[model samples]
Target: MERITERYRLAVRALGKFHELASRDTLNEIERDALIQRFEFSFELIWKCAKELLYVQDGIDAASPKKVIRACRETGLLSDAETEQALKMVDDRNLTTYTYDEAFVASLIGSFPEYDAVMHSWLEKLK
Candidate 1:
């Protein structure tokens, strides 16, 4: 339980930083890359937080991001629509690993607002 709480706190803090970067009106290449990195960090922490919370709160033991997300929906931490968006967020996070296409980067960054909103809502429910 303590571990779950700690993870949730960390996820919230990291998401706050991600939200700060995502809210910026304009970013150069370096800043854009930094935002993506922050997204990666925030995404990781949040999903893992969900995993831990599920285990501690609901006796669910999801082992992957997608699984954790689906479990979150089952636990009422996420709605069906938010779960779908989160799955897309997972795909975007994975894409950040190997792709450097500028167009894709722009599209991903443009998605930050939605991502940020859903993530925030999910975290709120986790508490």
Candidate 2:
């Protein structure tokens, strides 16, 4: 498989693992932290795959979140609203990694379900 295809597969697998974690109703603090970390990691993986696909398909080099999301829109992979969401997600990803704020992490955790659903839908369409 091509690198982009491999990345997509990895992203899908990560998302699947995140889904498994989220489906459980009872989780300890450590489990919850792990789940959130998985969710964030999967989101980044999905975005990386999406950007790679765009690069392979259109010769577009998306170096920033806005550019990456714009590439997705230009390639018809995401609607305007989804692009907006993706941009926000990217920003949240950066913040989650760089900042030491619990509230930001909590907000990102809350967004995981939508992120997973959007990524899964896009992957299905791509396949």
- State the local distance difference test value for candidate 2: 0.77
lDDT of each: 0.93, 0.77
- For each predicted model, how many residue pairs clash, with residues at least 3 apart or on different chains? 0, 0
Off by over 4 Å in 2: none
Report the number of the highest-TM-score candidate.
1
Candidate 1 colliding pairs: none
Model 1 lDDT per residue over 1-127, tens place? 8898899889999999999999999999889999999999999999998898888778998899999999999978999999999999999999999898989999999999999999999989888
Say what the RMSD of model 1 is: 0.8
List where candidate 1 sits over 4 angstroms from the true fold: none
Name the 10 consecutive residues with the lowest summed lDDT in model 2. 118-127
Clashing pairs in 2: none
Q: In candidate 2, what are the lDDT values of residues 71-103, reduced to their tens digit? A: 888888888877777777778777767885778
